[model samples]
Target: MVTDQAGHPLFTTSRDRVHAEGLWHETFHCFVVNREQRIVLLQERATGKKDFPNCLDITAAGHLLAGETVADGVRELEEELGLVRTLDQLEHVGVFLEELTLPGFVDRERTQVFLTESNQAISDYHLQATEVKRLVAFSFDAFATLGDETTTEVVSIEGERFGRNRFVPHPPEYWAMVERSIGQSSM
Candidate 1:
């Protein structure tokens, strides 16, 4: 688990808290896109994770270490997603909050959202076993429809050794937001 600048758990100050003591901790989130207007990606979190297992998060995301800046953590995409894009290749989409409802979860993050465009096939890269379990590709619309219909599609993991596939259902509003983000990024 990642800690805040104060070296404390983020759940201590979530947005939902009246005094949100931990909300002061900063974090970042980045999104990637392609020229075809496709949002670059999101991975199916492995079920063994401590939080939000098997859920869909940003195309590429991680917490900023206690002394790290939002940009520093966002740069992890090159290693996590195996993209060769530079910091300039990423475009910030401002910040967003993903509050946790698991009571006393003491977490509120200032997500530094970003967007980028790339055509690189993810199959060439490797998946971080600790962070992601597999991957899936869908046009923004396809995901939107799946979200609205509660359809769980398959995601395949490509990594250093082999790949694994699994089915997942994601939030519809997220794709709707992604579509809008992609549209805005293209502009």
Candidate 2:
């Protein structure tokens, strides 16, 4: 298997591996935790989408194309949220695989996660219209209680109305990384 400079696996085939085919588009997701650590901003994907439509998910996330470095998070920050960021502004928490099976295609994604603390509200953001629709900020503790199958869901953002399971999207590993970072700072 061919690999990029970072050693991430590239695209392939049975006989000859098509480098362009498996260039592996990467994505960045930011968990903007507030000062009191009470609220976390969440995004609601627009209804008109081919994959993961209308899901209540992380605050801001997007893919990093071929040749894009993980450090491009700063640029992504500006493009996705129209905010400026320095390398020190964002904490590179972790990387994890997020797999999703849509109707025709499957997204086996390698997501680079980040966390930052700020008083800035997303209301000041001018989001990318093609990718993002609306934003929702919720309390962190309350969000943890969500996705309870036994509890009745008043509104299903990621699941069908009749579906029993509440989908808490995003890999738990990413969150765990942020917790680790906090632990380091306390020491």
Which predicted model would earn the best lDDT?
2
Quote the positional error of residue 162 for candidate 2 in Å: 14
Estimate, for each residue in 76-112, the C-alpha lDDT of model 2 and write its tens digit.
6677567677767787776766555544554555677
Worst 10 residues of 2 by lDDT: 12-21
Judge candidate 2 at residue 59 and give its lDDT.
67
lDDT of 1 by residue, 23-53 (tens): 5455666655555645346666777876567
Model 2 misplacement above 4 A = 1-25, 146-168, 171-187
In model 1, pairs of residues that clash are 10-106, 11-105, 11-106, 11-107, 12-106, 13-22, 31-114, 33-116, 33-117
lDDT of candidate 2 at residue 38, scale 0 to 100: 57
lDDT of each: 0.56, 0.57
Model 1 residue 185 distance off true place after TM-score fit, in angstroms: 1.5
